[model samples]
Target: MKQVVENIESKPSTPILGHVSPSDVECMEEIAGENWNEDCAVYAFHSESLFIIPKQRNIKLSLATLKSEIYTISPIRVFDQNIRFAPLGLLRWSSRSRGLHHGTHRMHNKNQRKRLWPIWVLLEH
Candidate 1:
């Protein structure tokens, strides 16, 4: 966790251009392709792939392919649970996979229960 924080702090922060509302599923589709879902958006944010343009107020996201380039419609890469930080399969488990409310799972005391909040990411349509 310290390494992750160090890595993030080392890079210059990118200015946010605009917001993506929950209603804008279309924009999410463009980035994640067909069959896009909440997991896709979550993955993008977790992987730090979304960025803003120099002169544009709109935000854009890019998915990496096997060649380590921005992905396009026709050429899908190995984007699955196998990738680090990718949402794990519903039934499968692995060292890199984190379950829903991962932090809460370790809390055995009832008083430690905390309300889980939803994550909201705004995407342009």
Candidate 2:
């Protein structure tokens, strides 16, 4: 089912949503075929695409394809999860394959009860 919103309703201009809502899907379709802008960027966390909605029907975008770039944690590419400042460094993460904070979110003391000491050292130190 396709629902269209002729005029956007009240919502966060920049919502750090966990998923791409149904409206976002419709918006994506519209942007894809009808009125996509380049300067306006869409943060589709659910769909895992960073849309660059500029001012036309065809905007720059990053949709999940087989060849989509995968940002990963390697010994060289990203900082180690055990580094001294790893906790402070985890302010915001951007990825295409996973939703925001899918894997690296902060846990509560209950969850932390099961972790090893070194892991806590990284998070608390």
Backbone clashes in model 1, listed as residue pairs = 20-122, 20-123, 21-122, 21-123
Alpha-carbon lDDT of model 1? 0.31
The lDDT for every candidate, in the order shown, is: 0.31, 0.31
Candidate 2 Cα misplacement greater than 4 A, ranges: 1-38, 56-90, 93-125
Cα misplacement distance, residue 2 of candidate 1 (Å): 59
Model 1 lDDT at residue 62: 36
Please provide, for model 2 over 1-125, each residue's C-alpha lDDT reduced to its tens digit, 9 standing for 90 to 100: 99886985866344222322223333434433332222333443444544433233342344433323322211111134443221112333443333222224334485455432221112212
Measured against the true structure, the TM-scores of the candidates, in listed sequence, are 0.18, 0.18
Clashes of each: 4, 11
- Candidate 2 RMSD computed on C-alpha atoms after optimal superposition onto the true structure: 18.1
Write model 1 residue lDDT over 16-125, tens digit each, in one string.
34443333444643544444333432222243343322211333543333222221111111234342122212222221223222321121357766654332222233
True-vs-predicted CA distance for residue 125, candidate 1, Å = 30
lDDT, candidate 1, residue 108?
A: 32
